[model samples]
Target chain A: MIGRFVARRAAMLVATALVASVAVYGALFIAPGDPATLLIGGGKPPSPQLLAEIHRQYHLDDPFLQGYLRWLGGMLHGDAGQSLTYKDSVTHLVTERIGNTAFLVAYAAVLIIVPGVTLGTVAALRGGFGDTLVTVVTTALMAVPTFVMSVVLIWWLSVQWDWLPAYGAGEGFTGRLEHLTLPALALATAWLAYVAQVTRSAVRAELASEHVETAWARGVPERFVVRKHVLRNAAGPLFSVSGVAVAGLIAGCSIVEQAFGINGIGALLVQSAAKQDLAVVQALALITVVVFVVVNTLVDVVTAALDHRVSLEGTA
Target chain B: MTGSPPLLVVDDLRVDLPTRDGMRRVIHRADLTVPAGTAVALVGESGSGKSMTARAVLRLLPSRARTTGSVRFDGSEVTTLGAAGLRRLRAHDVAMVFQDPRAHINPVRTVGDFLTEALITTRGVRPRAAEAKVTALLREVGIADASRRMRQRPPELSGGLLQRVMITAALAGEPRLLIADEPTTALDVTTQAEVMAIIDEARAERGLAMLFITHDLALAAAVCDRIAVMYAGGVVEELPARHLHERAAHPYTRALLASRPDPAATAEPLRAVPGRPLSAFETGPGCAFAPRCAHAQDLCHTERPSLSPAGEGLAACHFPAADARVTPQPGARSTPHGR
Candidate 1:
């Protein structure tokens, strides 16, 4: 059952990636700008013959379908074309910045998942004062935008206290962690609140379910009731919502990355888009789409595995 | 079993729950007992506090629920027992089978895990030994291929099978008293009979005391040694199961017996007790059932009746039926009670 589910998901992943690639490629292709002239002519009024030659050389003169197919074929063969803005291979540009974004997102994921789920579960179990406090705090946190949070953290933690770097991706693991901390925190604040709220509601619902009551009636300890009955049942919904939170985190990273002046794919995407760097933008958008699809698919598989009522046979 | 000292004695047990309105007395000074190796059925309609009385026995009421009366289980005071004491009591002495087996059993867990969890966790039984015991218990409850069934989760099992599995899980602790709160209510009629039979056999074989809660008075009469009829959160009559139809002293018991549909009486419309069932909050100062009672007098409406001995058992009624002779109806079926 699990094997078939994974196979189906893999096919879905490939199809989703192809569709996303087409959309991103088409959007960038038809967008109002000429990347070849922008790069080769450098905003000057170059000779008409020279501009024509540049367009031909760069395959800009090719028909839309032909150009897109050629790009897709090159992508299949490990080539992502050259970035007109950076004057480098799109793959190299993305690879260099991809690590920084991955680090930032991974760091934010830990921040969001750990404390978010913990506080939420605690709030649900303890209720009353603890529950009220968590609800109030998470609500307040969610109201603060990511960029606003970034600015505040930069001002408070970096400018005022001078505790860490305010901008840029630092070298080495420790330095990167130190530099990434504020941006990740800024990026994660909203998601952490969201995940906690979801977890709190899910866990609360599970706590009220008959299975938890049965466990309590059976003389299972309160802790075991929460662990085996409540948490296990709540995990499916938590995992599912966390997938959406992860995609949100990735989307929000562009703003956070720009705020921190970090050379991550998020920052690269924003800068390249502004410059109309179609190859770089298309590549980054395709990667983001793939990641979102893959994460959501994994969440579905894991949720089905955890909950017996959720069938892998498409009945669900 | 009747001569022996009761395994559980609940004396004037009152449970008040805080609701949106106010503190509503859900169980109104209920008095009942379950003797060793016997089944005592607490029969009532919904909201009649039969389940509340059962929950009170285990100190398992909701957090806002406050109980003001005494419950003694196996010589230990249940209401006063601390958390650890209550845990030990529930773990070693009492087990409960809820109404819906599918809802009560955790869906993510396998049948084996659900059955053996309490044994391994609370009793300190070895996992292998617990598994063996669970397998045997499942078989004893009439489930076939118990070992293979153990690996499957609750959703994989039919309602009847899951209910049997629930019973097997309950008996895994070898509890001295089993509290079955409408254990067979969620099953079909045939499955209900089969499950009840399994419970009856288990009780006889283990000498387990049982407090059975149900709305079906006939089923109660069939399985239990004694029946306690509840109305508006209070038990109005207590009598031997055999005498429930013939010697019932309380008017409410008579009404309940009359309301039960008989297949042979299809020529006549079924008799139903008049008036809506009252919540605890809706009861007045007098008898809660007075509004619906055909025999209710002005005294029954103004003053409550305390339980007193009437004929073979206790009943709370302004005028006990013992003083009046009750002849069996002419067309009444000769069979004892249940279909």
Candidate 2:
């Protein structure tokens, strides 16, 4: 059953790749601007020899299908093509940006998971005043947009207090962390709210399940009941949500990257789009789509692991 | 095992749930005493609140639910104990095997991990020691190839196997009182019997006092030493297992006994009580069962009944039934009450 699911998933991924390649090929045809002239500018509009040389060099002079095939073939060979904006290999540009985004996501994920889950659990355990307080705080945080939160955080922490860097990707890991901290926290603000809410609801639902009642009847400690029984059993839905949230984080990071002036994938896509670079824009769009699909697939696998009721075949 | 002191003493216990309007009583002043190592059954219908009464004794009631009166487990006032004390007591003195073991067992965990985690967490046993104990427990519960099955998830096992594993996990703490709440409800008849045998074996081996809650009076009769019949929010009857089928005094008990199918009397239609028990808050000033009782009198409606000795058993009834048995037919194979 697992093998069948894996095979079907791999097939779906291949289909996605095919569709994405076709879309990218179509995009070049539909785009109004001519890349050859755009590259050289209107200063005597580069001689036909120079234009032909540029087209031939980049494989742009070939028929659209042939050119698309060449690009797709390069992808198969682990090449993401060259970026028209930066005049550098797309792979190098994407890799550096991806690393920075990954670090931000990792640190922010820890920030949200550790505190958000703990607060949720404590709220569940201490039901009356504590729960109400958490609900209020998380609700307020949830209502605020991430970008708006970023601006507020920056003004207070960087502009007003001058504690951290206000803009630009920092130097090393420590420097990058300092630069990414504000935006990550702003991004995490919404996620923390979501995680807290999911955690609270899931824990409460599990606590109400017959099995938890059985555990209580057996004299399982309230703490153990909440920790071992409730959390683990309630984890199925939360695990799936967390997986989807990771995908969302990647999408949201683009905006956060702009707000924080981090030279990440989001910034790259914006730069490529502003320059009307069809190849780079299409590549970035397809990469985002692939990320979403892969994350959703991982969510299915995680949920299946947590609960026997979910069949992997059913997901396929 | 036979001569041990009473393990749980529940006296005048009342569990109530709070709603928007007011408190709606569930278990009403239920008093039950189970001798150590004895099996006591709390038999009731789906909403009769038998489960609620059991939950209150352990302080496991939901936040909105409250309990009045005392629950003394092994001479400790369970309600009065602090959180830490309750945890200690739960870990060392009591354990529960639940209904629908398939859903109760954590699906992601291996049987070995589930049992070992319980052992280490509750008993504070080291991992190595816990593993050996878990292996023995798995064997005792009749799981063949214990080592191999130990690493398998709950879904990989049959319903009977899962129940056995739950039983084993319950036993890991060596609890003095074992609470099995309709533990075989989800199993097939054959598997049910096997599960019962496993439970009985474990009970005898450990001399654990069991509170077996079920709606199946026949199954309860088969396993329990004593039976308590709960109706509405109160226990309507309590009697020895032998006396229940023969001399059940409460009208509710008699109706329940009559409802059981009789294979011998093929000509007679299966009899069931005509109306359901009134809602907990809907009970009249008198007997809670008066609404459904054929023998209810004016006094039964006007005055509430308490647990008093009626004929050979303790029951809450204004008018106890004279004959608990069904009028026997000539070709009767099994007793009218035996299913």
Candidate 3:
């Protein structure tokens, strides 16, 4: 049963990517941006002959369907055409920058899920005073937007305290990790509060459920009941909520990247979009769509695995 | 009520819960006893504290609730038992089956997990061995394809099937006593009979003592050897099952007996008590049922009555019904110890 279920999910993942890729490519194609004009210098008016030569070189005069087909075929292989301004392979540019974004997102994911779930569980388990404290702190944190959090964190942790570097992706593993810490924290601030609140409500609901009561009444020890019954039952919601937060992170934190001077994919997308670098934009957009679809698809599978009822409903 | 030693005794149990008005009592006074290998039914309407009394046996009360009475199981006080002792009692000596089996079970888990979790975790039985044990117990509870049912989750099973699974879990502990809290209240009439039959047969085969809680007095009298009728958190009467209809001493007990529609006499109008049932906190110093009692005199309105020997049972009424002999209906079903 599990094998068949996973097979269906795999099919869904591929189908979702196929549909989204087409939409992103088509939308970007129709969007107002001329690559040939972008490639020629904007400082001086170029002759018509030079413009036509550039258009033919990039196949800008080709029909939309033919151009899309060519682009799709090239993407199937290890090619994404060439950048308009940088005159480099779009694929190589994306690959070089994707790693930094991936690291930043992973760092932010931990900052969001770990502390969020821990505080949420504490709030649920310890009612009265402690619960209100966690709630108040998270609520206040949530009110601060990501850019403001970035500014405040830099002001307090980096600038005033002189505790950590305020900019750049840094060098090597430890150095990069240390420098990325502040950016990840800023990016995770609002979402951490969101996940924490969601987890608190979910855990509290599970605790009040009859199943947890049954486990307690059966003489299951407290630790076992909390781990096996309460948390295990609450796992589906946690996975889903965190999955969304992390998947959104994969699209890239442009604001954080800009604030911290990190040359990640978010910065690349913003820079490329400003210059009308359609090739890089198209590639990154495709990757973002795939990442989002894949993350949510994974969430569905894990959720169905944790909860049999969901799997049944999914198949039904 | 029997010569056998009492397996469980609850004496003058009172549970107070926190409320906006202050500490309000939910269980005013409840006393019950279940002899070894005998079934005793605590029957009452909704909000009668029958379920609360059953829950107190396992020390399963709200964290903020305060209690004033003692619960003894196998001659040891359960009310004051330490954490370890409570765990030991719940694990080996007693187990409870809840009202809604679906709501009480982890829906994500297979029946096997629900059944063998305690055995593997607390009892230290090997996983494979626990699985085999619960599988056998499942078969005993009338689940023919025990192995297949074990792999299935709760939502896949019908109400009757899930109740059988609950019975298996309850019996898996091999406890001396089982507390069934309205085990069949959520099922339809036909399924109710089947589920009750499974519990009855399982209890008989294991020779387990049972404290059955239900609002159906007829089913209680049929299945249990003794009956304890509760009113507004207090057990108002205790009597042998055979005397539930004709020899019941308390007016509240008689009123319940009358309130049940007589199926054979369809031409007669249905009977209902005069006042709505009161919760434990709603009662005053006087008898909780006084406003609805036909025999409520000035004295009955002023002071509450304690359990005193009346007719063939113990009653908590100032005026125990003495005219039962004149009102004996030959249509009353003769229910002996259901074997």
Candidate 4:
């Protein structure tokens, strides 16, 4: 069953990636203005012969569909073509910045999931004042946009207190961590609220389930009941919600990256888009789509495995 | 049965639950005793407080419920037991089998894990030893291939098989008092009899006392030695199971017995007691069953009757049916009422 599910998901991933590549490629065609004009000189009108040569070099003179097909063929062979603005291979540019974005996302995920799930569990178990406080605080936090949070955090920590750097990806391991802290926090704020709300409802529902009641009736200790029954059963729903949170975090990172001046793929995408770097934009958009699809598929598989009632075959 | 000390003694147990309106009394002055190595069934309709009375024995009422009473198990005061004391009492002395086996057993966990969890966690038994004991108990409950079933989850098993597994888990603790709360309600008729037989055999082999709760008086009579009939949250009649049909001293018990549909007597339709069973909020200062009782009089509405000795057991009726002068009303014969 597991092997079949994995095979099916692999097929789905490839199909989705192909479709995403086509859609991203189409965006470049529909976008106004010519990349060759921006590449040669932004405002100056170059000689006609020089412009024609530049268009030929970048394959801009070919039909849009033909150019896209050629790009797709090259991508299938592990080549993403060259960036118009960076004057480097698209793969090389993405690979260089992907690690920074990954680190930032991983840091934010840990910060959001750990405390969010823990406090949510605590709030569910100890309901009166603690539950009310968590609900009120998380609701307020969810209302604040991520970019607004970034600006407020930057002003408070950097401009007012001079505690951490407001912008730039710092050097070395410790320095990089110190630099990512502010950006990660800004990105995690909204996600933390989402994860906590989901966790709270799931834990509360599990606690009231008849199985937990049976555990208590069997004289099992309170701690064991929570660990073995409540948390284990609640894990399936939590995984599903966390998958959505991860996708949202990826999208939110671009805005946060621009705010903090971190040279991650998000920052790269913003810069390339402004410069009309079609090759880089198409590559990054496809990567984002692929990541979202893969994460969602993994979450569904794990949820089905954890909950016996959910059939993987039925989903397929 | 009369000479031995009772295994469980519940006296004047009253449970009041706080609702949106006010504090509503659910169980009022309920008294019962299950002697060592015997079975007692608390029989009643739904909302009659049979399950609540059983849950009160374990102090497992909902958070908003307030209970005031004495529940004694083997000379220990269950009502006053501390958290550690209650835990020890629950682990070593008593265990409960619920109605729906599927709903009660954790779905993600295997049958073996569900059965041996209490033994390993509460009794400090080794895992290997607990596994062996669980397998043996499963066999004792008539489940085949115990080892294979242990590895499978609850959803893979039938309702009857899961119920038998629930019994095994309950008996795994070697409890002195087994509270089976409508354990067969969710099963089919054949499975019900099989489950009840398994419970009876296990109880007899271990010499355990049981408090069985059910709405079917006939099923209760077949398995239990004594029957305690509950009405409007109070024990209206207590008698030997054999005496329930012929020598019943309470009008409600007589009405209940008459309501059962006997296969042999198809000439007459099943009789159901008149009027809806009163809820906790609906009962008054008078006898709660007065509105539905055929023998109800002006005095029956003025004063509430308390349980008093009639013949071999107790009945709480002003005009006890055991009196030779009072014959059953002619029209009160087998007429079906609402369930």
The clash numbers for all candidates, in the given order, read 0, 1, 0, 0
Model 1 stretches astray by more than 4 angstroms:
A41-43, A312-316, B1-4, B323-326, B329-339
Write one digit per residue (lDDT tens) for candidate 4, span A71-148. Answer: 989877868888877899999998888888988988898889998899889999989999999999999998999989
Which of candidates 2 and 3 reaches a greater TM-score? Answer: 3
Instruction: Please list the residue runs of candidate 2 whose C-alpha ends up more than 4 Å from where it truly belongs after superposition.
Output: A1-15, A40-61, A77-102, A214-227, A234-239, A290-316, B1-5, B204-207, B324-339
| Model 4 C-alpha lDDT per residue in residues B1-339, reported as the tens digit of each score | 466668899899999999898899999879999998889999999999999999999988887799998999988889888888888888889999999999999999899999999999998999999999999989989987999999999988999999999999999998999999999999998899899999999988999989999999988999999999999999988889986766677888888877778799889977778888997567888888999999888878878888887544788888776532223433333322111
Q: After superposition, how far is residue B267 of candidate 3 from its true place, in Å?
A: 1.4
Judge candidate 1 at residue A153 and give its lDDT: 98
- The digit string of per-residue lDDT tens for model 1 on A10-109 reads 8988999998888988887888867877777555788889878877767877888999899999877868888887889999998888899999999999
Q: Model 4 misses residue B139 by how many Å?
A: 1.3
Which residue pairs show backbone clashes in model 2?
A: B264-B333
Docking class of 4: medium
Q: Model 1, residue A227: what's the lDDT?
A: 86
Tens digits of per-residue lDDT for model 3 on B180-268? Answer: 99999988888998888888988888899999999999999999999999999999999889877778878889888888898999999
lDDT of 3: 0.88
Interface RMSD of each: 0.9, 2.6, 0.8, 0.9
Identify the CAPRI category of the predicted complex in candidate 3. medium
**Candidate 1 lDDT score at position A9:** 78
